[model samples]
Target: MQNPSPTGISKTVIWLMSIISGLVVANNYYNQPLLGLISKDLNVTESAAGKISVLTQLGYAFGLLMIVPLGDKFLRKKLILIDLILVTLSLLWMTFATELWMLYATSLLIGATSVIPQLFVPITAELSSETQKSANIGLVVSGLLMGILLSRFVGGIVGEMWGWRSMYGIAAALMLLIWFIVYKMLPEIQPNFKGTYFELMNSVIKLAKTQPVLQLSSFRGAMGFGSLCALFTTLVFHIERPPFEAGASVAGSFGLAGAVGALAAAKVGGLQKKMSINRIILYSILILISSWGFSYFAGDTYWGLIVGVILIDLGVQSNHIMNQTNYFLLKTNAVNRLNTVYMVSYFIGGSLGTYLASVAWKYAEWKGVCVVGLSMGLAALLAHILFADKIYKKQLNQ
Candidate 1:
């Protein structure tokens, strides 16, 4: 049965939504901080460790295409609950994997099931009025961003104390708790589209080709995510070696600093009211460039690295929020399809970042990783500046 709309979005619902979104999204990142530990324990190399990041992202892309669209065609509450249960089992399975292949398979499953948060974000946006959309998006995005940043930190600590296996166990238990809360609090949201899965999938593909904003946002988001991924992927490797020999916990602490950057974007809801999104992207690009430049000299001390992470994430998160907000403003009816296009590209870029980080680390170490990050930031900046006027006109007309 469809649940009645509340007098307003309840605080209970908002709190539950944030927690559920944060934890579900955290699934994609559990393998990151543990990459080092998993490599050593599994008797694998850094290159092999890259698969965890790549496969998880590939799995997320697959889910975005095949799973997220279901939100537009089915009851969101049921889908969220089912996926949560599946993810719980997947995390539990991850804890039991003794072989690399086993871990890879479980990671893929976890990613596939973690699309629940994406489903929720779209639902929240759909539920809110235009006046409240930006704030609503920000609140939910805070959850998504927190999950991305905090997973590594939590995973690192859990991995250090109870071992890598324990980290998955912790995730599984948390999933169950989230499931209980969601079941109790979340309302059923009927699908907006009553089309067959195949028809919906076709529409998604069509949007990818026909929608310029989706294409552009996807491209820009992917590059930004790729750069971000490269920096993080290599960071684990860097901290585990050389002058600043640090453990998993120390490596994880950097995520907290990254979280600070995401928090800075809380003001984005306000900024969007006054400025054009193109202006937002332009400013974000400038910040990204400066952040990467900081990384060049920030290598020697943890504090310097913290500052670099903060700036870089601040740039990445604000631009992402702006891109998403702009894309959704396209055809309100096209939100899911546009999001599918945007996120598929975003994850693809993330996969590439993971792969390149491992490869670059092999040849040039931390310096190579930084170069990759810096180049991506610079290229994205130039491309956006070159095309800014056109993209802005296109979006405004849409």
Candidate 2:
């Protein structure tokens, strides 16, 4: 009889990948909570400062498209190391920015290089055993989620204590530290594709047209992410005004609470084994909608904001993990390409969310933002229901 397949993972390797990838991914969120302080330091208006978020996300989307595909054609370890170096340089440049434009430029570079986490997660999926793939993806993604949830608070605390610029300096140092660890611990895995770069690029682009699963997953992921982004974009504003009157430091502290949900996704990695991915997606979307509804009451007290953020983070991370797990199972050779498509849509939706949040703030304040979020949440649910059964069957067969 043939022997059962092996998963090829060591606990230490998984832990290291999770930690390294998590810290690197935190680069994406470094600016979220600190936007207010950074704007003040740079003497820019809130709307003007908002452009940094947009540019940074755009840069990331660009990298996910233009650079992440290198993973399928080149050695990921080397690619990640080079990316981290660029990120470190960008952060250092940010420390000395004398004008808003300089900061915006550096922010874009930082975002572009932050694709290291993206590279790491897909590689983890490729290496994991089929039986353990979901849990493994959850473990690695938990790091990414933690980075997102915690970076805001860290940015806030560091900005408050030292200065906004100092936060970048510290993040740069962390990047260097992460670089050293990745170089030391990560095993070298060469690419499978020897095709020309153009061929690989064309192949990835073709995925959008050729793969129904890819199309559906990317759209669902985008709508869910977009809705989540819409709610989070206004959270900074809500905590800063009126009934709350909280400072940036206090707003940052709320990020600490969001980390609870992130860690919970990791802790419940076992659930992926029992719960159908469709059910998880459906449940998570409901939680997000409920959270947005509750956030309408956030004006009553800061605790309302706190509870709402917690639920929102939990729902977003859980659904994201399931969505990603399904995608990674599609075709190993296509991981980077698939990720590029999904992330581009995801970032585009997130940018729209931020813009809508700013517009909402002008018209309906927190309530308007909540309405946008709730509407998007329901749309995401509908999108998922339309395709959940098909996706489930595809993943099961894989």
Candidate 3:
């Protein structure tokens, strides 16, 4: 039987969802700040170690394509629990990984199972009233953004104090605790689709082809995220050189600045009541361009890097929230599949950005990285300016 619509969602449930979202998404980012440390310990070059970040993101893209669609075909709460178990196991694997290949393989698993946040996003949208939809998603995404930022902060601090492997061990323990909490507290959300897994996956592509807004939003989001990844992936290499010569902890501490932007971006969802999504997209793209401009000029100054990081995150996260809100509103029953299409594209872009940044760092160091980021921002801006007005008019008429 089809489950009855959720009558209401409590603050406690929202908070729980937010925390779970934060924790699950953190699995993808914990390796960013720790990359340098991992490289040193594993006796790999910094450039070689950056591939771990790329592979992890690629794995996430793969999981979004493969596992997230299952959220529609299976019971969501049970599916989430099973994935959390996989995440915990992956963290445990990372803790014991003594070789570079072992770490790479475990990182892929971590990224794949860390897709729990993707499941939670559509669920939050499904549970809320139309008026509260953006706000609730904003709250959940805020937790996600916090996880992304704080993962760097905590990973750096923990890795510094107890070594990188110890950091993974702690993450595994935390995942286990969250697992129990979720199993006990989360309500079972009945499956919306009754199709076979193959049909479910096929529907994802069909939805993307039929939905123009989804395509534009996905493209703009992909570019914004790609730029964001370009900066973060190469940031440690920048700080560890010349005037700064900082440690992993210092690199991770930049996330604090990013955290501020993330919190601010959460409110962007609430602005949907007041602003058009196209306007939000335009402003976000401008902010992204300006952010890379700041970084380009910041050079070795701590203040410039700090300000740039804040702007970059604010720009990217705001764009993300806007894109997601639009897609969620498109199809109530197919929200998870919609998310699968969008998020899979998003992370694939991120993987490419990280890989390009690594290559850029090898060539022109910080300058090359900045150039790559700025170019991506400009490309997104151009696409938005060209296509967004027509799309917005169509959406309004519909």
RMSD of each: 1.8, 3.3, 2.0
Highest lDDT scorer: 3
lDDT of 2 at 219: 73
TM-score, cand. 3 vs. native? 0.97
Tens-digit lDDT track for model 3 on 30-112? 89999999999989999889999998999999999999999889998889889888899999999999999998899899998
- Please report, in order, the local distance difference test score of every candidate based on alpha carbons: 0.82, 0.79, 0.89
Q: What is the per-residue lDDT of model 2 for residues 50-148, given as tens digits with 9 covering 90 to 100?
A: 777777878888888889989989998899899889999998998888888898898788888888878877777777788777787788888777777
lDDT of 3: 0.89
Best by TM-score: 3
Tell me the tens digit of each residue's lDDT in model 1 across 222-317: 888888998888788889898888888888878899999988875687887688778888798788778877787877778778988999898888
Q: In order, how many clashes per candidate?
A: 0, 0, 0
The parts of candidate 3 lying over 4 Å away from their true place are 1-7
Q: How many angstroms is residue 246 displaced in model 1 relative to the true structure, after the best TM-score fit?
A: 0.8
